[model samples]
Target: MTLKQQLTDDMKTAMRGGDKHRLGVIRLVLAAIKQREVDERIELDDAQTLAVLEKMLKQRKDSVSQYEAADRQDLADVERAEMTVIEAYLPAKLDDAELDALIAAAIAETGASGPRDMGKVVAAVKEKAAGRADMAVVSGKIKTRLAG
Candidate 1:
């Protein structure tokens, strides 16, 4: 099944199982996906859906950080749980060493020379690693490579 269909089925399962937390997160994801479809007037493919899931996960990560900074452990816990749910829909992430190697290859392939080449390098990396790696980390590696 497609990722979107799987999510819908999961939502139904969560409801049947009376999983309130999981259901809430699933609903949020479904709503986000639906909103994007409505706004764009096109159905999202798996990659597009994964992009949306990644964005939601990133938002939860930021919320988790803010909640922790405010000493709101309860809120942070909720965000964390939501992250766990969202992450299940994403592909496995590349480890730092693996990510670095991929970035290095992209930089070389694109002949990225310095900070001016950061955009080119990022575009290449995104083509190869978008759903499999975090862009923030990829950009950091690119910056360090360019600086040195």
Candidate 2:
């Protein structure tokens, strides 16, 4: 089944199990997906769906950090819980070594050398590694590789 179908099925299961928190998160994801489809006038494939989930996960991470900085443990906990739910839908993330390997391959494939070629390298990396690796980490790796 497609990712979107799986999400819909999971939502139904959550409702049946009285899992309010999980259900709410699933609905939020579905709504976000729907909004994108409406706005773009295009159906989202699995890759696009994964991208949306990744975006939501990033937002939750940002919210968690902001909440913690403000000493709002309760709010932070909520964001953390939501993040956990969101993450469950994502594919397994790449570790640092694997991410680096992908980045090296991308740099080589693009013949990217020095800081001037950073954008080209990043675009290639994003095409290959989006949703699998953290872009911030990938960006840092690109900077280091270029600087060296």
Candidate 3:
């Protein structure tokens, strides 16, 4: 099934199982997906849906960090739980070695020799990595590779 369909199915399962937390998170995801579709006037494919999931995951991670910094363990735990739920929908992430290999290949493919070419290399890496790797990490790696 498509990712959207899977979400819907899981939502129904959550309801049947009386899983309040899971149901809430699933609804939040579906709502975000629907809002994006309405705003863009188009249905999102799997890749686009994954993008939304990644964005939500990033926001949750930020919230977790901020809550922890403020000594709000309860809030941080909630965010962490939400993040775990969100991560279940994402594709398998690339390991460090695999990610490095992809970065190296992107740099070579784009002929990126210095920091000035960072954008080109990043665009290439983002296209290849997409949901498989974090863009922030990829960009950092690209910067280091280009600068050194």
Among residues 3 or more apart in sequence or in different chains, the pairs in candidate 2 whose N, CA or C atoms overlap within 3 Å are none
The digit string of per-residue lDDT tens for model 3 on 1-148 reads 8999999999999999999999999999999999999999999999899999999999999999899999999999999999989999998999999999999998899898999999999998888888999898888888998899
TM-score of 3: 0.96
Q: After superposition, how far is residue 126 of candidate 3 from its true place, in Å?
A: 0.7
Give the CA lDDT, 0 to 100, for residue 46 in model 2. Answer: 94
Off by over 4 Å in 2: none
Identify the candidate with maximal lDDT.
Answer: 3
Give, for candidate 2, the lowest lDDT window spanning 10 residues: 128-137
Give the alpha-carbon lDDT of every model.
0.93, 0.93, 0.94
Task: Indicate the worst ten consecutive residues by lDDT in candidate 1.
Answer: 128-137
Task: Give TM per candidate.
Answer: 0.92, 0.95, 0.96
Query: RMSD to the native, candidate 3?
Result: 1.0
Can you write out model 1's per-residue Cα lDDT over 7-99, one digit (the tens) per residue? Answer: 999999999999999999999999999999999999999989999999999899999999999999999998999899999999999998888
Q: Runs in model 1 with CA error above 4 Å?
A: none
